[model samples]
Target: MVNISEKDIQLLQEQVISLHKEAVEGNAKAVKDLHQLLERVRSDHSDIPLLDAYHGSTMILIARDKTNPLDKLRWSKSGLKLLDGAVSSAPQNIMVRLLRGKAAYKLPEKHFHRARTAIEDYTFLIKRQIHGEGFLNTKRYWQLIYELGEVYHRIGRNQDASICWLKLKNEAQDPSFLHLLQLKLKLLEGKPSVEYIPDAESPISNLIRRAANATESELNNRLKQQKK
Candidate 1:
């Protein structure tokens, strides 16, 4: 195993913070600085797999969620196009395809098929656990599954969409996602469950429960108000 010191982690953190500031401010120098920082880290810890994953993940923010439009590259296909092609060759191809889907959302409606394909590839990667493919958080997995279901539903593939939603409901331990899933299931079953938002609270599980309760309350309120 390669030895990494606390000092190294601190240095990486500092670099990431600086890059974020520069990225937000649309500072061209910060863009160059990020490249330099990445190169420096690569030079020292060339063999670390996790570092590559971190970098790939960071690329998602830089390429998609960066604050400054001026700082944004014309950004075609997730800006994997802008970064070193070598960075694209991380342990697994999951991040690459996921990023492609993120970018695909901004593309023209005509490109939806491509977007769906990209998301499917990432989902497959997750299912196969390729390249450390992730569903680390239940919410993230369910979100993707629901999105996949949405696309499927649009294409009138009701069965495939149902499968996606069912898998999502099962994977989501968070009651909010699960509760939402139940409603979706009911609707698909011809019951038409109403939409609801759980109330916000501390701790993830409680927060989800609150969200579910909030939804029921909302429905009751709507029914009450409707008589006016």
Candidate 2:
């Protein structure tokens, strides 16, 4: 395996972060510009499969815009193919796996098989954590746990989801994350069975909605207090 320098990794991370911001804001031109930057990096470092994966994932993000549905589908499929090839070539590369897992998680229900691929990646990371080989005691670790919990809930494994959130709640010190876990747990508690119905919205979505509503209410209350 070709080794990437720390400086190179840092530069790539910064570029990816900027790309993510542009993608989230739906800036197609900025995303294209970022892709060009990545292409330059890829040309300079042709051995880095990670850059290929990033470029592919960025294309997927660009496809999320409300444009031609058929073109969007084509781009998404192309991205997934690139990701799959990268991962297949480097099965143990955590960075590539993370990219693929995140991309898979956002796919529609018609792509449940692809979603399962994300679940597999998350499961592998958790297993690595158990053996002290993966990230521990870090925000990234907790975020993975949270995402794994959401995946479990999405797939109707309520019990597993509850366990993941409970573990997170026990270990979490951050007030906001703890509150979110508590909300997740609360939503799970009233269910009669461990199996969540596929037709219903997942508890995670409810948690998000509840959190948003709480934030809005709090902001309104603060405004009222200011007026008083």
Candidate 3:
């Protein structure tokens, strides 16, 4: 590991802060600035663990918003190459693969396997939490999970999509919300939410409501007859 002086790190910190602001604001200029920061990181603090991660994530964003997906792929590969060269130096480097897989997935749907692998790596990294940086903030694991699921769905893989949604659905941890989400998915896929009511908003939801109301009244009538 290359040692960087505190003074140099402090200098880099200021630039990184400004670059972060630019990133949040969606400034077109931020991409160039982030590239410049990565260059500085490589030059000044070659083995610092955080630098490659930050660079990898920024490169993923660049790949995501590029006017041409093909051109973005080249930049994405370049970022990954940089990470690959130093991956041994930064042994627990989930961000690099995660970013690369996300880029590859964007470039082509056939690359879903790559995205899946990246997600797996990230999950392990999150569990480890090797650094103080909270893994959830550092990575978009859930978003990628959803995206991967959607990609599978696009390829007519309902079963695979269901796999992802079931995990996501279970994560909600509320039975009511879980049922709502399940019902929503049923609506999305043009399936029935329940035996009596079809899945739909507005008119269909209303129809379901009316059906329930009628059933409630029927139960009340039965109760009244029994009471008599």
> Which residue segments of model 3 deviate by more than 4 Å?
1-3, 6-25, 68-70, 86-88, 93-107, 110-113, 126-134, 137-148, 151-160, 173-228
lDDT of candidate model 3 versus the reference:
0.52
lDDT per residue for candidate 1 within 66-102, as digits (tens), equals 3433333333233434322433455345554554443
Candidate 2 per-residue lDDT, tens place, 1-228, comes to 456798978888787777866774568887888778877777767666777788778877766653555555667778888888888888888778888887776654333245477788878777787788855557778777877787677667788889899998999887867777888889888665457455434332332223222322453353233223
Writing each residue's lDDT as its tens digit, candidate 3 over 61-169 gives: 5654565545455555565565445455655665554544444444333322233444444445545543555655422444445555544454454665667667668
- What are the TM-scores, per candidate, against the unseen true structure? 0.44, 0.70, 0.54
Query: How big is the positional error of residue 161 in model 1, measured in Å on the Cα after superposition?
Result: 1.7
What TM-score quantifies how close candidate 3 is to the native fold?
0.54
